[model samples]
Target: MIIQPKQRNIAYRCPECASSIFGIVGKFALSADMLRLKCSCDKGSALDINKTNDGKIRLSVPCLFCKQNHSYVVSESVFFDRDKFLLNCPYTGMDIAFIGDEQTVNSELARTEEEIRRLMAGFEAEDISELQPEDMNEDEILPDPAVYDTLRFLVKDLEAEGKLECLCNEGSYELRFCDGGVQVYCERCGATYTFGATTPALAEEYLNIDYLKLK
Candidate 1:
């Protein structure tokens, strides 16, 4: 018997900006191991889907949801059994993206458009301050509280002492928190430093080093 090729479709969105990145559909053989795509944002962030050795699909991608990159693994059946797989931000429980077959994605997009229209039909301005990410509880919104707090304090301290200023005389640095850690970046110079925690107390140790040592 001849086996039919599997077709896949993926829809991406940056939860932080509530923006739709893109929708792509393609066909692959049963032996295909991985698929990769990029976000629509100017950042051109990456997203990857890999077929693991254990016959599961693993999604390793940058999340616009919590401003971090992380990985997620799902059973192989997820592709064939469901019309869509909605991936959520593990930290904030916000919908980050969806993947499935082409037909399902098109249908889902139509439904979403209709709902958007219905809501906008009677839309009105309201105070949206409560919706801001900063207003969210750090412990609840961060995937790893210990790492978040440790890095948050360290970066804030560095910034306060002017240790985070770019040598190119550009500007100060800022932190973007994600699943397991944070990204330190300079806006004008585009420099970045990343820290993560794979074991207990790793982030804490990294935060305790002297400023000179950090440089």
Candidate 2:
């Protein structure tokens, strides 16, 4: 007889790139203080797992629907004993992460993607340009909430590290939200760095940037 280690597959969508992230978690993996599951996108987004002194598992999950990180604590049985478990965004009620048997998780993900495609098809038929009033300026349009929030968080982190600067040698900067992206500009020199955030791929790419140079 052979003994198999207790393990379960985990899956989630990259909050920055909207790409599916998959991994496996073993019962022994939690022996450490922390376990991190990072996306292959290399966008700095990851799922952190911590075991509490009380034998509870704490999960820090990143959400694309609400542009926020959510934390949940569960018993060890709930984490490893379930055949399938799903974590959803509280605000949108959309599944943000999955943990269970590999086949179940993969099937659910495919169904979710199909639903999204159907919704997008309907959205494409509408004339979005006509919905906006002709008198409305481009600046009046609100940026995508997920993209805007991600950029804002990145900017704050960069500023804290003293990596955000302008050619004029000024560290003070401001953000301007436009239709498809946001602009970081120097308050004193007016130098600017414009980045696209219209798509998840673009946003994920920007997340890799460590320093911002306004020119």
Candidate 3:
């Protein structure tokens, strides 16, 4: 008879691009000095797992909400024995990383995404009249906040599904908002995709985009 090694699913939202990253960690891997899980954005956003000499586990997590990296340490048993474990950002109380069975990790990620959408919608409901004249920069024309947020959400969703790409295969993409539209550009190779985001109709049209290639 053979005993299978214990394994756990891990997931985190990238601080740089807000894309969900998923991976699996095996019990044997914990025996090593360190393990790193990186996001596809290739922007230095990653989760690090380190094994201490005292037989404990150390986790370095990147938080999408706080835009920060947080560190925590726990016993080996707590790290590997739990059916579900979540690490959250202290500032926002937002879950930064998830470790557990595949189903639970995926469910938590979906819930988090839905919660963020609702929060953004709530912000959009605020009165536009509340903005003071001092808040406007005469020389800077900003894009519609709601439209920009929608574009950002769509871009991250595409990124998570591996549907966003760049002409230069090695380059990773990032999103930028302009006066009337949004841009998806590769940081390394300068490949770009620009499209209008001045209206909800334009943003909704992108929902049908199954793949995007920056050139």
Candidate 4:
């Protein structure tokens, strides 16, 4: 009996020279919906396959020559050949090639931060005049309430209290800190992974541990 490794279904083409290149597919993270491929030309390209179907997938990297980001697409084929992934930059005609996979930790972390920011923004734009404090017909003074300030203070307080936590973009197990370990778990998924200890001394040792927003 013989054992065989799984084969790839990669394909790419160059933008400038229209050259074809082969790639080695590696790192398939189903949890993160990610796939990584290394191009033969020595340039590495990382993509989010989950985003491809919706036309949201783009080269994980910004355009090297143009520095332009949008308007790029990263699609896959059931019968794709690695040769299709190779291409020259249409704008610069440079040898545009790539190899390698996206680090799920980094990409997912950045994506979570982005979601947090967007949520903060939406919370900011909300009209809270009705929820504001103002003077009444009487001569009584009032406090501003300061919901945002309070929230910020709570965030800091939680960190100091060793309860700082956050959630990743996946909307699953939250990034919670306890016993000096960052855990990813949800009652539903039951997925939990300890990241690091609760102290700074061990922070470096378990630097790669994933964290979640404190609830």
lDDT of all predictions: 0.55, 0.67, 0.69, 0.34
lDDT tens readout by residue for model 3, 1-215: 75443888999987666788998887787787588999877586889888878776777787675455666665565567666777655334456688888999999899888876676576673322222123443225444444544555566557656788887667655555554577767768898888777776788788788888888
TM-score of each: 0.46, 0.53, 0.54, 0.24
Provide the global lDDT of candidate 3 against the true structure. 0.69
Candidate 2 deviant stretches above 4 angstroms: 1-5, 119-215
Worst 10 residues of 4 by lDDT: 141-150
Q: Candidate 4, TM-score vs. the true structure?
A: 0.24
Candidate 3, poorest ten consecutive residues by summed lDDT: 125-134
Listed per candidate, the RMSD to the true structure in angstroms reads 17.0, 16.7, 17.2, 19.5
Mark the regions of model 3 whose C-alpha exceeds 4 Å error after superposition.
1-5, 125-215
Those runs of model 1 whose alpha carbons end farther than 4 Å from true positions after fitting are 1-5, 15-19, 23-30, 107-141, 144-215
What is the per-residue lDDT of model 1 for residues 7-29, given as tens digits with 9 covering 90 to 100? 66776655344455554533344
Q: After superposition, how far is residue 130 of candidate 4 from its true place, in Å?
A: 55
* 1 or 3, greater by TM-score: 3
lDDT score for residue 123 of model 2: 63
Worst 10 residues of 2 by lDDT: 125-134
96 Cα displacement, candidate 2 (Å) = 0.7
Tens-place lDDT digits, model 4, residues 1-215: 64332333333332222233344453243224565433334343333233455533334332333332212333333112222232223233332333323333234334444643464476683322322224232113211212212222233233334454444323222233334444434434454555444443444454332333533
Q: Is candidate 2 or candidate 4 better by TM-score?
A: 2
Best model per lDDT: 3
